[model samples]
Target: MSAVSPRPSYAAVLRIPHARRTFAAALTARLSYGVVPIAVMLCVTRATGSYAVAGVVLAVFGATVVFLSPYRAALVDRYGPRRVLLPMALLYAVLLCTLTVAGRHPGASGLLLGVIAAVTGACAPPLGPTMRTVWRELAEDRLLLQRAYSLDGVAEELLFVTGPLLVGVLVGFTAPAVGVVLGAMLMGVGTPAFVMSPAVGAMRGSGGVRKGRRASLRPGRELLPPIVVAGGVGLSLSAVDLLVVAFAGQRRLGDDTVAWVLAALSAGSAVGGLLNGAVDWRTPARVRLPFLAAGLGVTLGVAGLAPGVVTLTGAAACAGLFVAPALTTAYLIADEAAPAGFRTQAGAWVNTSVNAGSSAGAATMGLLVERLPLGVCFLVAGGVSVGAAVIAGI
Candidate 1:
């Protein structure tokens, strides 16, 4: 039997160059995203006046992202995340400017906004999954990779919590366009550096490892597992987003409400990831999958009972408890599942799944809100997460 190497000490784990770059990248990416919840919604609200219209606009944006993310991932795989990331980042920034300028033409605004959104969506950096791929590639120590994922979870939570509030403040105090421009600049500056870090470059150069490693990293290989897992998880996450909108719309919550609820959930997910990394649970994922399912079931089920924004956010937080760890594990699984030189595809597939799921969730919930109570929407969203957990179990 092949002996698995012993895991490294905490000190040793911290020394890995790849892990540091990932840490830096995670900080930047999440921080940039933090500004999005407020910036995007506020832009729509200011332009359209009606919350439903804003919601529809958001839904369209989500749809564009879902459809285009796979192609972006393909680029990442073909040229490396660095090669695609800078141009994509710059294009995203330009689109934000376009969205800002197109606001005055109500008749043509929606179409122009949608077009710009699609462009930005196509360029949205593949940081989350790409970073995960880098972690696996650069960190020889499994423990370090695990830590990086866990830290990433924490960073995501921080971003979601703080990002929207920052955007909200900017929109409220300054201008909606400011938020977009700033978010674009931050993303453009931060993501490219992360993608181009020395550590990430080193991993890209490992040409003659085991066949699986070579094939997974190769530019033109089909890696199906990451695609499946990413799609499933992304769909589940999208459902969660729909529920957030439902809750916000139901309570007639202001533009800031969605950001708060998402933040609450993010906090829980961050905690879960941190615990998972720290504990270094020796058990198989098969053992952990059931618990994740139960959490999803309970969290989503309770969200339906939320009577106000506070209760809704609370329930959402509970639901979030499973998010990061599940996502991180899914990335790992995708890496394991992919063939040589195809890691970027795996990451891209994950992004595509999320974008797709977000679009579907937004559309479904937006319609559902037209006919049902917010609580019911939450229940449905929660149900989606539970369903995802159950499917993962199988």
Candidate 2:
């Protein structure tokens, strides 16, 4: 009988030192995101007695981050992450403290909450880029980076799964403000701790500004376009995400369906990211861009069919096929586009673009959800995806 080979473990695939640190950082940051939804809802509801107001606050908060992520990223590359991280994190913690105290007055609470959200968004630290940078700096090969990002995606999904539940318990048993308190504590602990690590500070005095600025100027490079494409893709994805939940609820499916559907989406994205990482061929963005767009278009377009959970999940997977490759492509482009001095900021620009696109897609979908069928929303999202593909191909 032939001997069978055992499957390799993920850690073996990555083969990097202090990789667990990155994973730990991702966990804390993601968990912090989970806390925000609960905190915002609680803060707005207790003070204004209106869920709508609370939602608006959340939207505004997200918008601020989406808009500012690029700038913050640039700052990280220019000045090094440590300089940018501490101040922003400190500001965010301070805002949360203010929210805890100002919870009673509705007018005061709304204003404070919005300010806090904006500050938090701005100060959220350059985590995604910083983490990626760390992987690039430390990992022996591209394969390791792929594993790092895949693990990051999984960690993010877990955060969504666990963060809200913890928040619910805290709010239900104690107070919604508890979520804020917990998030702040985590942010305070996590952000600074990561920044203070010797590996991170070692890069601090290195050429952050010189490299970042050069990358920002080169338009012919791959980085700028992918970031643009990703932003649009992110927008569409966010819309589909919310629409799926809304449609499920309308069908009288339980809230539990939301988690399941989101899981499908996350699973798809993770799979796509892993697949992209595994491929060794160094394909140009122009070649890869169409596939990414087409995959998203098809996935999102089919989503409007509003099939059973199984069908919807399949569509989600199809759409997600592009997620990681597209991102990888953008990062590659950024690497090419950025001079040595501007590497980090160029990467951050890509991150910012994605956040902005997601914000736009969510807003546009919200408007559509009111007047159109859920299926129509899916079609619209798909069409937009197709358009993005065509544009990216050019």
Candidate 3:
């Protein structure tokens, strides 16, 4: 048999000099994501004594991000990420501070709190896209970029996991508002550094995208597939989230067991993303993407039908294995497909679709979970994933 392609070396990847700083800053910025919603929930509950009100406040933040991501990204493409990133990062902190301070007072109205949360999210810096842009700028070649994307995907998974844990620590040791406060601090420090890094500066100075290109909802003439596919991934994830909680409740798993089970799913994705990155693929990303999307849906369906936590975990892992590979490919494709100067906007559009899809999927799957068996909820997620595959193929 032919010897397997050599594993991509992480040491080599990190040796590029600019990589470490960008990675550090990107990870730092990501940590805040975990803290914000939970902190907002906690802060709101503390002040209003109503989980319902807190949930609404959090939802407003999510909705605002979905709509505003593309515009913010367009600005980054126009003026360079620093011009966009620095100001937004600072504003994000200020908004968080406003919300935090307002949350402390009984006189703060829900409308005021919700408005603050919305603005904070709407003006949030395009750090996620900016980092992806950095990777594209820094990677030596397509293969290296593939490795970078895979590494980035895995790191993101870890960030999501760690972020919540950090917030938990803060909430336990200090106060709920402290979590949001810390998240804001992370953004304030991390985003500016990330945007100002040498790799980012090189990207801005390269003048790849035209200075005056008009922003559009269109990622590019060619980017619609990846955008839709990303949306589907988001849709399935939200459904799986709800299903996992329902499964834990149905099985009478302890309060904390749900967290573990969810963590297992994410753990599987992280492992899969790392492994995928190490390989040299023979398949074109476009062909592989649909298969992976379809596979995730099927695996998730099977997992939903599983009878025990062990089986469910196995199934979840199988599905998770497909996620990063598909996402990495999509991001690569987006880079290729984006109109010149619209790189940031292209990433933002993909993000916007995913967030929008998530909101829709969560709301839709939520209604189904109320009426259907928990196993069927997995099937629903699978159906959504399959639809996403169809979009990818289209």
Candidate 4:
């Protein structure tokens, strides 16, 4: 009789040596990402006394962060996190402090704020991709690696949710700039602790791209499928927020109802991420990618046909069941496709695709929601994911 393989669990992933400490430190710094946006937005709005200026500032900030991610990740790949991440985090923290001080007083120049915000975004450390790189280093077993990524993804999801609520609590007690200060402190403290971890130290020697391996760092055909699928998933998911709001308004649902519907989508993604990790599948991640994307696309398309809020919520949950799984698979595919010494850059590209798609999706959906029927808008969004899956599968 063949011996049975043990079922993988989140516990096993955490049990890997240094995994707990490294992940904790990474999360501590990453939570700043969740906190900084809302805090900065409110701070800018208060100082400039114009939502329009605040909006433009944030747009500039986000554009730099999203579009420049791959280059930032390359720095990590070249110098390793120890040499690169600490300086980036320190510079990022200092910039945030400068912004906080400048924005503490009213009538701060919006143009100056925009310049600062743009530089700040550019300096934002690529912690997420770096942490994922560490996970790759720590978990050599494929099955265990899957669980690690899932846990990382799920925890990240919660951190973003929690970050905003934490800022909300901070604002109740003091100014939003206080929240920005807190974000700076988190990065200052957490990043040093993360780099000191033994696991990260292990990666130091493997920093530079080996000769003849430089070409592998470039986005090749193997990397394209995951990038395409990740972008599609992001594009589809981004529309849900606006679509849900429009859906609720059309049905006269309360704000709380809208919150619950959106919450359901998050809850489903969390559950799906865990289950996806737990399964011991025979199929490769690439084979699973298209199917997962299709599942999301199909469910979201059906969601458009729901007659009531409750039914719409159910459909949204079903569609969300595939979100984390698809992204996880995409990351897995990207990791596999990337050669040694370039994992961070490879992961960053996938991350970039998701953010870029999200930006496009939001702009596209905003236009569509104003002109087209909401149901038709949802179908259009779903079609994007399905179309991506088809292209990726080919």
Per-residue lDDT tens digits of candidate 3, residues 194-287?
Answer: 8778888776632434455455536554787788788888899888888888888888887676676777778878888877777777877777
TM-score of each: 0.77, 0.86, 0.95, 0.96
By TM-score, the candidates rank as: 4, 3, 2, 1
Residue 317, model 4: lDDT of: 88
Worst 10 residues of 2 by lDDT: 1-10
**Per-model root-mean-square deviation over C-alphas:** 5.2, 4.0, 2.2, 2.1
For every model in order, what is the number of clashing pairs? 12, 11, 1, 0
- Count steric clashes of candidate 1: 12
Over 4 Å off, model 1: 1-14, 44-57, 104-108, 203-263, 302-317, 366-380
Candidate 4, lDDT over the whole model? 0.89
- Which consecutive 10 residues in model 3 have the weakest lDDT in total? 205-214
Cα-based lDDT at residue 206, candidate 3: 26
lDDT of 2 by residue, 1-394 (tens): 1122232235655455556665576467657777876776787788777778788778777777666766676677667878877788788777776666777565555766666666666666667767767666766555555555555655565576688889878877887787888888887888877787665766663444342334233345456467667776788888987898887878788877776777777777778776665555455556776678667877788778856877887777777767766766666666556665556667677777777787788889989998998888888887776777777777
* Best-matching candidate per TM-score: 4
**Per-residue alpha-carbon lDDT of model 1 for 86-165, expressed as tens digits?**
78777777787777778744443665666676667666766666676676776656666666666665666677667776
Give stretches of model 2 more than 4 Å off.
1-9, 12-14, 104-109, 205-221
lDDT of each: 0.65, 0.70, 0.81, 0.89
lDDT of 4 by residue, 1-394 (tens): 1222475678988999999999999999999989998999999999999999998998888899988999898888888889989999999999999999888799999999999989999999988889999999999998899989989988988898888889999999899999999999999999999999999988863545565456236798999999999999889988988899999898888998888888899889989998888887788888899999988998899999999998998988898789989989999999998878788889999999998998888889999999999889989989999998998899
